[model samples]
Target: MTDFESTDRPYAAFPVRIGLQVQPQHAQYADIRRTVAAAEEIGVDVAFNWDHFYPLSGEPEGLHFECWTMLAAWAEATERIEFGALVTCNSYRNPDLLADMARTVDHISDGRLIFGIGSGWFEKDYDEYGYEFGTAGGRLDALGEALPRIERRWARLNPRPTRDIPVLIGGGGEKKTLKLVAQHANIWHGFGDAETIAHKHAVLDEHCRTIGRDPGEIERSAGVGNKSPEDIGKSMLDVGTRLFTVSSSGPDYDLGLLRDWVAWRDEVNGE
Candidate 1:
């Protein structure tokens, strides 16, 4: 078995992707676009934005925009950078329709879309949007049902995704969520330090084994919060994780951490 908790694996090996989640609350479209441009110019691998109606941090009534629409605009604005929501609320749209929208965005980005999705959580997004924010279990149930519908829709949608758009599921719920990740997600993003991540990863491995899926086929990812990549840099790379994302909340959209993380990725990857 490959050890994913040490930073000595050729140090300069494996595919490394550095991502930034641009918090779209309290920012103008111009600033958001500039942030995207800066991230691309600075060599960030993937630039993302969250899908929310109300700001998660700061003033709840602050500025926030819809996700897929911003993504489509990002697709048209930037070149050479992958784009998607950090995670889209699954309850907001029909799975088939979501898949089709992703397909369209894929073409717009010349195949740079990552279909990052999750079961809808924030109650405001559900309530105000007229979506029923069901129980967490029910929501996971919805997500599980949505994934296959999306894939099927992609296969059936005329013109298809410009590329085989990857599905990224973010959640750490071991029982149902990780199981779904094992079965369907191309990338899995979770919130955990090394030990928790290792435990969850092991559980996911077991899930993969049970379902006859290859664990190696899924790329592990995590959000970089509070800690600078400079501090936890090697630890992240050690854990079989190739995708690193740092989230920036708006009003500032500060990217100092993200820039540092990107540098760390480049160094670790020998770029």
Candidate 2:
């Protein structure tokens, strides 16, 4: 099937959700905190920070903060916005420990948590942190193994998660990534233009069909980085995408772009 081929599938049952990933780099904690607070005030549904030790762009050694800790802070700070890492690196922490942390954060947020995770990438994060920089396939294999452990730990935790913490898995690797999405993810995040997203959507659908899971059960999320939110969001919506994420970085975690996207989402959902 071509990229543009429609699956004749129904739109996702949920209303459109707008997410803002405020990169925890080149900024102070207070600044990041303000950004998230502003985002929630402006009607952003989800607030995200990526898991990494160093900056991913701009100055490499620029100021940066840790992921889960910041997520915990975000949990305490925001009352309405659901929060998590855009995609937590599965290789960074032991799976069981991660589950417990997630549970704690769930309580902190009073049940507003989305446990977004993915196979580890970024050799720099691995090498500098003394983690083995293995091949991509190896990392994915490790992730596949860890996901089950995380779930099992969640089940066994004392005062279990306040809710079934939604897992949002990122990436568009057709074979392994999409397979894991079908098996595990409640929300699947992919980055690309409309055509690329449509193609991956088709691949994800196939994976779901193979696993006897309905594709509509997993929400599709797209990253709209500094793009025309209205134009691109409309395209994404046409192809069954309901979550649109816009990422802004620190020093000054501006939400002007995000505000536009939030407005677009309100229009789409008639909120």
TM-score of every candidate relative to the true structure? 0.94, 0.96
Which TM-score value belongs to model 1? 0.94
Error of 1 at 103 (Å): 0.4
Over 1-271, each residue of candidate 2 has an lDDT whose tens digit, in order, gives 2232235754456578899999999999999999988898898999999999999999999999999999988888999889899889998999999999999999999999999999978889998999997999999999999999999999999999999999999999998999999999999999988889889989999999998999888989988877976568667777878888988998977778888888877776666
After best superposition, candidate 1 residue 59: deviation in angstroms? 0.8
Q: What's the lDDT for all of these models? A: 0.84, 0.88
Tens-place lDDT per residue, model 1, 1-271, is 2333344322223477889999899888788888889889888989889888888988889888888899999999988988899899888888988998999999988999998999878998889878888799999999999999999999998998887788899999999999999989988898878778878878888899898987878888888787887576667667667788888876767878877887877676666
Top lDDT hit = 2
Give me the displacement of residue 245 in model 1, in angstroms: 0.5
Error of 1 at 237 (Å): 1.8
